[model samples]
Target: FLTAPTMDDKIKREILPAAVNYYQKRRLVHRLNPQPVTEIAYYTAGGGCLTSSEAVLRPKAEIQRLRETFADGSELYLNFSDKPWVIGGRQIEPLGFYASGPGFEAETGRKDGLWFDWYGDADGCFLNARNYDWLMEPKGTAAMGRGPEGAEPQFANRGDAVVKRGPLATDTAVAVMREADGSRRIRFFPQKQMGFVSIDLAASGFEPAEVVALDAEGNPVAGSLDGVERGSGTLTIRHRDPRVWSFRLTPGKGRTGR
Candidate 1:
């Protein structure tokens, strides 16, 4: 192949010239003496150059013979193809990055998992870095107090969890459930906080009704929600200086627009 002005220039300087010479000698000899010649291939243990897949499949004896005769960085062609050739094999190395632990929220009742990202300043590209969620805990705490899993080795988030999509901005109606004795009760939060927060409802069904925010204790906080037939139901958390938010919803019941 023709060399580009950039990367291929380095390829030409390092491996192509010698490979052309080696092939030329072989071709001349074949033209003069019609005897069969054994084809020898060289494989890169790590890798230095590129040619073809078959280049790395020669017998041990043949490969040794070629190596002993040629210099370390030599390149050669498979045949008389117009393509530029390199003698040595390719080079490979390990890939590297950074990892972090999971997160949990009390008010929202949602647990965020361990996460990871590439290590470096904001600029450099991460070669093969990926964003992953860990379901299990880390192995152990460092002597210096490091790692996300509470500085203790435990059955922390070790597996990946599926990313769940929250309800859309639109108001959607959902089911409401209460024990027959009214002792046990539950409520839905908006799509955003619903997974973690809970809302207190007077009853179910889409109607102009008052919805309030409640803690795990079931005591109602300040503020009320405007109920809608469609879209996620949102209740503004009142007491806290900056009001928190949650969805008013329920499952098992069919479609309620949010």
Candidate 2:
């Protein structure tokens, strides 16, 4: 039941041209595609960082942050506290107002001080005392290996451990990140760096992970950088994209791949 005026307003607000290129394969493309974004998905998926039904609020002595890590290594985080926290030096806003029911005690706990805040999946999305009239669209995935239980970072210092990104090694770059729902995933960049780059996997909080390289046009480079091995605090590589290269990270158990 969209009125003409409402429809017009939506068209004005939503129609962001995906690409400006008019000539594509020669047909003189006119209409551009809208980005594949389901605005209400997060709300429908139960709002604040969801976890499996079996997941429980971790012991106070175990994890210290509220995080939901997927089996694929992707992780999500949420903060309701006033204490400020930053992923890649960028401070994030806390979720909207919160209140609980009569018996609902706002129990708080932190795990072994490593990283991770766990909670049980209450029947459906926890319908805590949050304003339902307004929905929030969470943005920005954790920048890989800025040294937290965040994604985009697979393996940093192989044996040591990295808490923040250092200058020496190039970040685990994600060129065209496609979300699980097939939409484009957004990424954040840290301040510009100049000169040599060095990375120690363990120091940066990356586990042993498998890496694949993709070239500019999204084609995997068959055999390149064979000398690169898992970082054991001394690994070094040119700190920049190799002519628009994207690295794909997968769960690699041991020190195997090149």
lDDT of each: 0.25, 0.26
The sequence of per-residue lDDT tens digits that candidate 2 reaches over residues 193-233 is 11122434443233334445556565666765423454445
lDDT (tens digit, per residue) of candidate 1 on 80-177:
21112234432111110111111100010112432211111111111100112121333223322347754443322243222211211111112133
Stretches off by above 4 angstroms in model 2 are: 1-197, 225-227, 231-235, 239-244, 254-258
Give the runs in model 1 whose Cα sits over 4 Å from its true position: 1-136, 139-162, 165-178, 181-210, 224-258
In candidate 1, how many Å is residue 134 off?
A: 11
Candidate 2 clash total? 30
Candidate number achieving the greatest TM-score relative to the actual structure: 2
Per-candidate Cα RMSD to the true structure, in Å, reads 25.8, 17.9
lDDT of 1: 0.25
Worst 10 residues of 1 by lDDT: 101-110
